[model samples]
Target: MNLNLAVISGDGIGPEVVREARKVLDRIAEKYGHEIHYTDLLMGGASIDVHGVPLTDETIEIAKSSDAVLMGSIGGNAATSPWYKLPADRRPEAGLLKLRKSLGLFANLRPAILYKELQDACPLRKDISDKGFDLMIMRELTGGLYFGARETKEVDGVMTAIDTLTYNENEIRRIARRAFDIAGKRRKKVCSVDKANVLDSSRLWRKVVEEVAKEYPDVELTHMLVDNCAMQLVKDPAQFDVILTENMFGDILSDEASMVTGSIGMLASASLNDSKFGLYEPSGGSAPDIAGQNIANPIATILSAAMMLRYSFDLDKEADAIEQAVSQVLAEGYRTGDIMSEGCKKVGTTEMGDLIAERV
Candidate 1:
């Protein structure tokens, strides 16, 4: 197989972790007899410094032309610097948002898979979190409150802010279709979460999702209020197969879902389009405090490389090899500081990647 990948190593730990992911990919290519080409580009704080913009047109062009994109964490405290004085669209995180929009990546898939070996690392009780929570969250990335209308008004010398929660039928239908498709691939169950009781827009979302549900008769579809879903996630996360929700709900829930696995660094995400290309990334952010430190976890990034192989290149065997390598490494008691527990071998980022790549 031949593959061309765009590497947007955003900032801070982004470059560090992305390098590890690349190493894993190199190992996979060498072992599996595949040719993989990579084009590295700067983004986030680094791009803001060098290009005077968070996301350069050249970077976008590179991503668009590539077969797939692998993005590491973006955003840091450096965003508060004088260079960030540019317009709203020029912000570091805005670059990511733009990339998603430009690519029409409506479906953001975040899988929360808690391995049996890391059960003790979780903060929840042994029965609650340790038993293992394996679920996928299909978040509507390009729609809902995140892309809604906003207004600020001064009424009686008081500033009142209003941000709309809106979703059209087509947007809801596309994401619901994605969720149902993903559910079919996994456990054939879909939990569509919303706040229909209070918000009128959510009612429309519910209506649209229910309408879309008719297209997939074999898939079991259920609706839960966002608040109730949040509670249920902590109570019994395993009950969910594919948790589908709007943009804001997904953003918040996915972050919360990370804790189910004890560390955000363990989570990987894929922002996908209907086209062959997609954006793979870690669900964690750039930890500036530990930027240059070798202690930062690279599992998420490496796992993202696995996702790139499976989703982007259709390299199922290679993807499985990478995943098994990660699982095997974890099962062998290797751990990073964030997900480290007693009796586990704590290692730096490079060592961990080398261990996993060696296994691959």
Candidate 2:
């Protein structure tokens, strides 16, 4: 198979981590007798420095033409970077938002799994971490509160602020179907999270999700209020298989879930449209402080590449090779600084990448 990919090695440690991901990908190509064609482009601070804009029409076009996008973290220290001085729409992160919008990405899959080897790194109690949870948070992106129309004004004497939170049946239904489809592949359980008691929007979300749930009889669907779901995450994460939620709730819950799994450096995320296309990236930030130190963790980005293979290209065997290689590397006691612990052999970013690639 010929894999055509758009590589966005964005700002700070993005280039370093993405380089490692590509190295592992190269190994996958060689071992599987497949071909990979890479179209390297820039976004975020790097694009800002060179093109004076975080994203360009040309970059979007190239991304659209590719089979999938493999990306690393974007942005720098927001307080210190010149890129942040630009208008809000021109900032590095704004480019990411634009890219997702242009690519028509609606479903975000964030897997927060506590690996057995990294169980000690988990912040949860020893008993909780020992149980080990592997759950997927299917977030409905490009909708809900974030995209709603909003304006703040003073009515009479007092000032008031309002951010519209809206969801239609079509938007709700599509994401619900995607969640159930993913759940069918996993453990066939979908825990739909919403704030139905308080908000009309969430009420509508539940109604539509229930309507879609009927189509997937094999997948078990349940509902939970967002607040209680948040508490339940740390209380008992292993209980969840796939969490399906709307935008704002999902945005908050996914971050909360990532924390329990140990390091954000070990988590990978993917955003997908209705089609097979996807944008894969690490769940962590660029870590500007460690950008040039060669100590940043690249496992997240490497796993992201694996997601591109599995989700976008349907190369399940190839993806398994990369994931198994990551597990093997961790089992060997090799670690990057972020995920390092006592009694483990700490390695630099390049060496860590080399270890995983050689294993693959």
lDDT of each: 0.88, 0.94
In model 1, which regions exceed 4 Å deviation? 78-88, 156-158
Clashing pairs in 1: none
Q: Estimate each model's TM-score.
A: 0.95, 0.98
Top TM-score hit: 2
Per-model C-alpha RMSD: 1.7, 0.9
Give per-residue CA lDDT, model 2, range 99-196, as digits (tens): 99999999999999999989988889998887889999999999888999888889897798888988899989989998999898889999999999
lDDT of candidate 2? 0.94
Task: Compose the digit string of candidate 1's lDDT tens values, residues 201-229.
Answer: 78998999999899999999999999998
In angstroms, give how far residue 316 of model 1 lies from its true place. Answer: 2.1
Model 2 residue-pair collision total: 0
